[model samples]
Target: MENNSIWVGKLKKLEPSDYTMSILPKLRIHEENVMEFLRLSASKPEHITEILKMENNSILIGKVNNLIFSDYAVGILPRLGIHGENEMEELGLLAEHFEYISEILRMENNSIRVGKMRSLVLGEHAVEIFPKLKICEEGGIEEFFMVTDNPENITEIFRTENKNISVWIRKAKKLRLENCAMQIFHNLKFQKENVIAEICLSADCPYHITEMFKMENKSIQIGKVKRLELNCYAI
Candidate 1:
């Protein structure tokens, strides 16, 4: 019988074990079908990894595999609680799926931490609807400091009093920052130096504020200590 006909017949069998051992072999005879099966079985992490190692580069094979793997990783892996000590292993398998799916989906947003597979599906539609969704920064202290006090702007919020700025800065290094300016200042003295002067002296200045100074050079003193203090209070 033809491979297609064989696959059709196997699909009719309705048994996963039978499908795994019997139909899978025949379906894999063609690179395209093999890719398809690999994708459909993406929740089966071991199988998907094996398929990724295949040499075939056919567009259909790649596309279907990607779709299947993405769906399985993002959609299926989070729900499994298998028998025996394999439960955590199963979740680990799903985590690997999320990692691979994120890469295949060309997602650059490190903000969506994939400790589990469920988050994959959570963001899948957003990515499809807006490919730019992946460009968004993961939330952090800098983000919090940017748009706080606006009820509509808050999504996730964390606050710590007297937290060291350096510690937060270190944590931010592990996250993605999309088009945000970052700077650290040392030895800033409010008694003598103006806020504007301190900012001007700093190597890295916020872009928008710097632009305002450029457009109105005389209005903004380059190194006036008193003016800088007032501006700091306003912020």
Candidate 2:
């Protein structure tokens, strides 16, 4: 038989501390695999949380209804933490559900005409989707709003210098008065004194306009008439 005893003796000659240190990398690899297995086998929320605490290094967090993970998993895991493929898949599904719920909420009408039952459903859907909506300034307009749904088509409407402002006002709900020099007479005919005109100095429009109804010298807030995204579902 080969002298296996000689190799054993050589290993024994190393200090106990040295031997322990040498195996640490391998032990960590094994521990990572074990944690991954546990994550896959986890069926209940409690089990997932327990496993997550053990592998607290993982960027992914699994909850009863949601799973959160980093956007870049493959590049991030070995450096920051580790996660199993199955865990990533579960996280993807959760993200899809979040997106779906958000789209439903955005498509639902929030107008004054919606009945109580429909309004309740829309409110619930809005709550569910609020977290996922992407918010940005609408063409430098400071008024912040959520864009839950993307429009399928976009059309531009422009009026000439001679066109009646009143006609455009009646047709427009949102207005983008960017690069034009025109005074809009509000609640008056050919009267520039009570004009609500916006001026643009830059190549890009400096101001955005939304249509409002005036009653008793007060502006009533109707739906905004800026660049709007219309849904196919909207009637």
> Candidate 2 lDDT, tens digit per residue, 1-235?
2211122211111111212322212222222231211111112233222222332233321111112221111111111133322122111111112332332233322211111110010111122332222212122122111121211100111223223323323332222221111113233132222222221111122221122112234342323232343222210
**Local distance difference test scores for all models:** 0.25, 0.22
Q: Which candidate wins on lDDT?
A: 1
Candidate 2 segments whose C-alpha is farther than 4 A from its true place = 1-48, 51-223
Q: Where does candidate 1 stray beyond 4 Å? A: 1-39, 56-97, 105-235
Clashing residue pair totals per candidate (backbone < 3 A) = 6, 4
Query: Compared with the true structure, what per-residue lDDT tens digits does model 1 show for residues 1-235?
Result: 3222443321211223312422332342222231222333433445444334333221121112112223334323222111111101011112222343444335332322222111112121222211212211233222111211112111111123212322333222121111111111221112323222122122122441333344433443223432222233123
lDDT of 1 at 145: 17
What would the TM-score be for candidate 1 when compared with the true structure? 0.22
Backbone clash pairs for candidate 1 read: 193-225, 194-225, 194-228, 195-228, 195-229, 196-228
Q: Candidate 2's error at 165, in angstroms?
A: 36
**What is the C-alpha RMSD, rounded to one decimal, of candidate 2?**
21.6
Least well predicted 10-residue stretch by lDDT in candidate 2: 112-121
Q: TM-score, each model? A: 0.22, 0.17
